[model samples]
Target: MAAGLAVTLATMTMGACSGERSEFDTRNESFLNDASPDAPAPGPGCGHQCSLDGRSVINTCTGETVQTCAADLACGAGVCQPPCAAAAADKSSNGCDFYFQEPRFEYTTISQSCYAAYVVNTSMQPVEVSMELEGKPLDLSRALYRAEPGSAEMTPLVGPIPPGESAILFISDKSPDTPLTPLESAYLGCPEGVVPASYVGGTPWGTGYGVAFHLTTNAPVSLAAVFPFGGASSAYSSATLLLPVPTWAKQHMIVNAWEMFRDGFGPGAQIFAAEDDTEVTIVPSRPIQSGKGVTGAPARVPVTYHLDKGQLLQIAQNEELTGSLVSSTKPTAIVGGHACANVPTHVTTCDVLAQQIPALEQWGHEYVGVGYAPRMGGEDELMMYRIIAARDGTRLDYDPALPAGAPVTMSAGEHVSFPAGVGEAFVVRTQDADHPIYLAAYMPGHGAAGGIWTGSDGRGDPDFVNVVPAGQYMSSYSFYADPTFADTSLVLVRAKTNGEFKDVSLECAGTLTDWKPVGTRGDYEFTRVILSRNYRPGDSFDGGGTCQYGLQRTKSDGPFTATIWGTAYCVSYGYTGGMALRKLVEIPLDVPH
Candidate 1:
């Protein structure tokens, strides 16, 4: 999808190839020296899936079956995947192994949630995925687990997540049909001119767990954690798609937002180790809370500790941890955010914020920023964005021209904030791929600057989202949408294939009819679609609301990016639906000479 930057990797061979020989010449030479017409006919097996007839391999993708690889594509990963998919993080999320951390979520009052995971089977064959909890107190009384409305049940599910169907593994209550509310939560929306929890500096009063789950990722599947129930379990509701352990790395930077009141936890970074005796180090962007024996961590000072497999440690304090660097003797995953936060320090309503931080290596230099759907105000919504530099002298340039007030450069570990208005699509890029940057989109508190902006979801609060860069997009995606909020929508950015825009479709909504063209930096475009709205909280999963939450998939002839957002009264959660955590190189289906 990043045609402009991607084309560079494809051109490196040219410098020493002016004397290149044609395919015919190469073939002639091979024929002369290694002719073998007497050999037997070629077999039907593909290289990776040799057991299956390459002529009729399983599509593996949703709603598709047996098919041969396209002429230019090779059969891999059980289907005809572009050569580039071999090393990208897109398909990596569906591996047969995954390690998930049951994060520490805090609230102001009566905080209790059905901690669960929404798992979607992305493989063709049925797979029995199971879980092994790392922490105890493993009591399963009235725990909700269901895949269909008519077949709701309590206790652990009998079978797998099931192919083509989605399953919610609830940790409490048996409500396959409904979610909790804020007033129901005995919670209050953040008010303007209020002191944040970080500034006020108090201990976390909300419920939090130190558990971890080792999912037998057998068969391909993708997962997302719905904070509590899919509903406004805590109008402080927030959720994020979880990346498989295979996509995690040895390094990560905690991306934090403005903190909340002193009651809940302030800006923090939680690190989970996958191996025993993993020596973890944290260079805090702010003072670190003394917890779990990490007693003397301070801002800018590196702290080291050991964690066995399945153990998690949260380092938090009164200051933000946005640029903190987390390194480990082994690969680890870091979930960063405030238990609840004001998007900007000067905002009103606060919302829970958290996202699995991608390893620095997975960051990209190019991106397209889009705001969450605008259901609260029929008009296009505005978003605040942050560009974090992973390397020094990271210069940023905006397509069509840099927006005023936007910084053109940033230093390593430094970040800049800028506003992106409605109905706008702009391309942001660094000098090259080496200067990768991380992008985070933010929704300011509804009562930001003391201005009233309330509607369908009530008085919305501040929220944070990790923006998936164009360079990390994959052709197809199978993600989850929480049906607990009043509204849910998607933001998609599509890049051209062979110099022309290709169509992208959402499972709930067919072919997209509206797309705003991104500048002339290359052939790029973006669109915002509201998947569901005006639905009562917590009823979508039970067939009573306007939105049905579950396995939501999207596809295009070429790679593209997608993000999902859910909004409730004074509450919302947003996260990129999926992305390829960069690893391998170029992805040109048709590499040129």
Candidate 2:
């Protein structure tokens, strides 16, 4: 998950559910504390020791150690208690203690026709989990399989899963052995046209697209969706995405576009409306290079569409949609990337790259744009960043500042892009929150001297990714590498002067190299974690490799941002390379006491 960013509150109602309820409360409520004015103040001679464990704080003062309440509880005047249970008899001297609820999970891509869903139990206790299809719960006992992390096999999940394990679920045309019961079909609005096996050249979910689902568990879990592409005989170009939490959704969004991997081919946008009866408006900031209705000219028109709960809209276009704006009456989820993109126009191979876009409201004013390792032969990689404004008159301030003539003013729905120096990291910020803006980074291909460079006439397609905002920076995150990628690298960022790196930890299913500070932008510092089959403890290559697969988890003492970069060779050789940034599922913040 990216870190927690401040959000404006807008009250909305959700229907209740039957059966076992989730242990977590989805409601956003505030807590109040009553502190006595006569409370004694600490004396100069009084020494204090304080530390945080999860959401709880441990403080040693006046020769005694006391643990404060969990994050959701209220601690005031040195007394800790659940905000609503201050007067309850269960209250104890240590505070009204309780377990923190598991965070809610929100997935943007779910289709029985093309993909499979996996959930990892990230907590210490066993948990029973269930699925909700389009807001309706399914039989918790049906269609569930469990597997250990990194395992290739799955068995029926007949009972609660133990800690540190995971499970898989599917959605598709029901089979005789895994038939969709009439009740389940009704809830999913199934029996639609089955996706043909030849769809997307026989990819896993090619012809049989199914309904999206929401998973609920008794404990926090990590969610992911995997799409195997490049035909059934060859699942070469596969893509994996980390599911986001619904609470992170906002009403506004902007996605950058690039030339299709091939000249005639274009990129596709998979948009999912997270809420019911949602009205979504998609405005094209630029014209479509190629598509059914597209002429040779650009299409600068806006299109509005409606979605029933759980419905998905897939749009493919040849021209770039960089400045496009997506606004919904309610929160929505979006996954945008090319089906396959050729980096340098001359290269014959291409890879799939897609990521869940965070809502615009989650966008922050400050950001540090970082790049992946330089291409082989020390060839400089070009980095381009786009700043999208959420409101009119938003002003941008840059460090290593923009070239003298770059524009600084951005109007709502408008976006501006500037080139970042080769192998350089830079910081950009807005004047205040009133002018929140989203930032995106792009790496251009074309004789770039890397794993997979393709282009024609010196023109190549660029890889675009949403840069994590400083406000959304988190202290911890868990992400997986595309099993199909030959090489992968994890980029980490933090305040340049912060020595919290000593508190940082990185664990991978495979080997993980030590952290190396790669660059700095203003007061922000950056580092890279190399993960590859050929990486050795003392290796100093430019972060490249093969078969870089597995889950990677990271944690640090202070707020920081991280993203994964993966690349492969030409498509003819069965390699398609691209990168996807991960967004964090936040732990709810404790109210101020």
Candidate 3:
């Protein structure tokens, strides 16, 4: 299975490099030395090392010379390069071509009268960013600068951020004297003749409500939406790292469940329709906490609703909605998160958690399950994962090294999960290529009964994260850091026999260790490197201070997947979660025969 996919990827690599020079003369000596003798040589019918296109050097399967570089690059020095050093000076003209044009944030709520969003320039150059509110250009002045983490004061953003740096944009509600129009009121879900509760005087930002924003930047950048509660000292916050609109979005999704009943906080799914007049149908596997229900049999019951462009619907309920399926007439973006949850019931505090749900079309057959560290002063915790099948007859194969009892087969729309001991990771793959599945890892939400919470705490309120599949993996990626989190770590997974890390850079944080294997799952190995500010004291969150915010970049010689895990704790409330490093959206290297 791996061999077939590798060859297809090579063909794709060739297609991308098809426009280079047509002749492979000795002056390009680097090409000959780079070509592996074991790689397929040109077939008997071919006479030269370069394909007829003159771009590529040689084909791995047929041994024929082929173009493997993009048009703007030159096949030289054993790799794609610019014709001149000056031509390659700009990062955007090289391999950094993919970008998100319209990145959307779903839950921008006002806390203490102000809300904030962050933009990190992932490119090597400066970027000009603009904001859009309800389809209109928002005045840049409305956005004030919130200080980066570990800083003492706030300032306005008046210039382009240097490469690899970040800027915060704050939005505050307008005064009540400027009443909202009926149209504006409707958009905010406010009843007629009344101002939205969020905008009313003395209303706290944590009114169980939020607004949406659409951000546009001239260069590729990662975004984070943050809401803070309480005052300084016991300042608690909830944050969600946002994903830019990919080149393609799907119309179907299998919604993952948020752990229910952690301090009475329930799980919810927020669906955003990006297109106008989209008809959405939602089938719930369990009843919702909002007192909404369908009349038909449970398996056949579905609630249908229509959404205009940029509108969103959120469903929070008491029951687990793990198996719920959402479908729309057009493409849409969805997010799953807990409104406020404790890792375990009876814990000291609970906070918000959210992750953007990848579309079903992006789901793959294989995944490596991993989780966050146990709560402070607590023993290792058990991690749980849910596997959902997208098609009929999905047969699963787990790493035999894992503890027994993981399910081996699943039917269409079927979902199941099992627990693994702390720090233990495993791989799961479908037996065939036709049936794909989605996997989600749940971190232990509850802490030891006597430790954090006074009451009994077993599994804790597990924060759910969508595990990225190997098929959706990328050789390069960039992600934003949760500046407010006290601690953060980078998790890396690669095929044990096939890939190796290359050029891993943690912008502002220092690497605690080199790449080291944490576990083996079949042919894949999980490795991790701790990333924290230079001042982090040991592994404890208490001494890490506020995490410094910046963009992180990681690349590998072969395909690999990764995500960042973060934890924030205060005397009053605490939370933990993770998000995928955004893979540059480009033409997939895998080509189906």
List the global CA lDDT of all models. 0.56, 0.43, 0.45
Tens digits of per-residue lDDT, candidate 1, 300-357, equal 8887778788766765556666776777879888877675565554445565667777
Q: Give the Å shift of residue 161 in candidate 3.
A: 3.4
lDDT of 1: 0.56
Model 1 stretches with alpha carbons more than 4 Å out? 1-91, 105-110, 135-144, 147-158, 172-209, 259-265, 378-380, 448-459, 536-549, 584-593
Model 2 scores worst on lDDT over the 10 consecutive residues at 1-10
lDDT of 2 at 75: 38
lDDT of 2: 0.43
Instruction: By lDDT, rank the candidates, best first.
Output: 1, 3, 2
Predicted structure 1: clash tally: 11
lDDT of 2 by residue, 1-593 (tens): 10100000011122222121242222211111112111233456443222212222233235344665564453333455443232121111111111110100101121122344445554444757665555566564545665433333445777886655655544323233455443232112111232211111111122111235555565444555434321111212233334333333435454534455444344555566555687766666665333222232234455666665655555555555654667677766666555444443334334344545556555566677777655342424454566677677666655554533334667766766555444566666666654667776655443444433422232222345567666555445554443334445567775432333335556542233444443232455676655642222212343342223355566655556666654444211111111112222122111111
Q: TM-score for all predictions? A: 0.74, 0.61, 0.64
At residue 351, what lDDT does model 2 achieve?
36
The CA lDDT at 269 in model 2 is 58
| TM-score result, candidate 1 | 0.74
